[model samples]
Target: MTPLHLTATALASAVGAGSAATLDALRQERSSLAPCDFEEIAIGGQIGRVRGLEQVELPAGFGEYDCRNNRLAWLALQQDGFIEAVRGAIGRHGAGRIAVVLGTSTSGILSAETAYRARDPATGLLPDWFRYDGSYDLFSLSRFVADRLGVTGPAMTVSTACASSARACLDASHLIASGVVDAAVVGGADSLCGLTLRGFDSLDLISPERCRPFDAARRGISIGEAAGFALLEREPLREGGVALLGIGASTDGYHMSSPQPDGIGAEQAMRRALASATLDAADIHHVNLHGTGTRANDLMEARAVNRLFGSDVPCASTKGWTGHCMGSSGIVEALIASLCIENDLLPACHGLETRDPEIALDLERHNRTARIDRVMSNSFGFGGVNVSLVIGRPAR
Candidate 1:
């Protein structure tokens, strides 16, 4: 099949609102993670909290359904002419010719948790202030975004843990390539909540200090929240836009919440992505690794990178700057990779001071400029779901 092109992309992560802030943070090796101040959960470490969500007013019709997740997406859509891009796509292709696909793990569950805490003991009904039935459902997020953008074509939500957004990109590319849709808006959004904080704490994966991916003394991961979106089309609508060369996905089905120890599934996913791109492993210039900073996740990804690219491709995990955004991590990192392609620079692993001796891979520990053409982004999720995407510079 002919490859689909990514006409435009935008990101909202802990680093900042758009590509400029993200690139600045990457260049300076600055981390957005800081101690959490929320009292609901006692988990320690840094979190990627968007700064100004509280200031934005929701649309008139969606007053009662507002939540942090939706609010963040709304704020992000306003950046980098992203909303205008989506509107243009719809106008050119017709609203029915565009599709909306979003990936999220928590959705708006945070709003539900808030409402649950305010339940009335007498009537067992939540207060009107906390009433948000539509905000609590996972499907509502996609619906909200679709309705706001007036996209009338296929709309769906993907929830595959960490690989959610990466798989969303895969699905969007497939739909455009198959002519099911002339264009697609693909990305993910997730907001911080007590449920996730405690959930990770219960598993002993919360770090007290900033996360240090690939560091020899790394402890665990720092949870984060983010929203990212991209526009994909069958052909380039503008010159010099990056092309989505190929995407590969696989599931090991090994464990419920842990990855395969041998990294076999991850290696397979990378191999498949290379195959789909019709390029050998040597063709990959950089890798945006799924380095969560947890002991197991980083080790497994290191092994997978070593096996797939033989330590030649420069790889770095941007989680140190953005924290682990969970479901939205894939799209955030994928956008970072896209920026690398556009600017011909490689982002540094912000918190990585020393490399683990056990891992035999070239980890980028400092900001470095390079002429990057082809790059790969890896997203491995719980249940051994793995996704790899290969993106290249626009074809000349």
Candidate 2:
């Protein structure tokens, strides 16, 4: 796998609106989770809700894309000078050579949810202003991002549940390696809505308190919303920068929602990623785990990690800080790996208090400093989709 440098990255989640706020939260060991309050969702669990999507306004020409999801994307793009970096890439590669690949699970489905309530009584027709292509469609985010960034190259959205955005990065790497594009804007945005919250509640997977991934007392996930983006280039903007080294994707087809019990799928994904990166397990410094705090998920991932990296790998899950952002989980956590590499910090498994007796792994509990050169992020989603990414400092 040809390494693709992540020249610039940005994030907007419950932790805060940009990478700086996120960094501050990580530095100060803060979590922004609050009681589930959006749209009067009658759920008991806490949620990582971003504060200002209602005030977000799309540019005048892109008003058709006005929805919570796209608004989240707009807010994220304004952060960390990410837009400026994309423009700079366009300047060098030309608009036709840059691609926009984003991920989302319920792309503005809330718009449709709201529209259903306003339907004409007799005909059950939605509001005339509602446009599915610009708002509710799965491709809306990518289209909005590509049009906003003024890029004309290949643009698409990946929607493989939670693995969507990580897979987006992998797909973008393929585009660059195949000479299909010179650069790519890869990330995703997902906004909170009643559908997801209630959906999880129905599955009995919502945690009443803040999620504690890999904790002995862990109960379930805390639903969240976030948007994150990174500029992936053929080469680093400068020397000694974090770059994408390898990617592995697999599906076990074991269950519709639950992960495979033995973790064979997770282990295979991590092994394939290492093979693609041409490195051994010993070369990995840390692992950003996909510990969702659900009983089955955390245990299954633990089994997988132990089988591959052994119990010694310093692993952690940051979901307690931002809740589970669902589709955006891939990009938010993947970018967190880059943040760890850049800052040389290992984030705490935010709410980990006591280790689970059954899931034995070297789960990180407190903030620490270490010489981290390379790391991996695992994103395994529903219906057996799995993806693992390896990120490291660009080779000298």
TM-score, one value per model: 0.96, 0.99
Cα misplacement distance, residue 107 of candidate 2 (Å): 0.6
- For all candidates in order, the CA lDDT equals 0.84, 0.90
Q: Considering every candidate listed, which one attains the maximal lDDT?
A: 2
User: What does the lDDT come to for candidate 2?
Assistant: 0.90
Off by over 4 Å in 2: none
lDDT of each residue in 130-162, candidate 1, tens digit only: 645557777777888888888998998999998
Clashing residue pairs in candidate 2, if any? none
Candidate 1 colliding pairs, count: 0
Q: Stretches of candidate 1 above 4 Å error?
A: 129-133
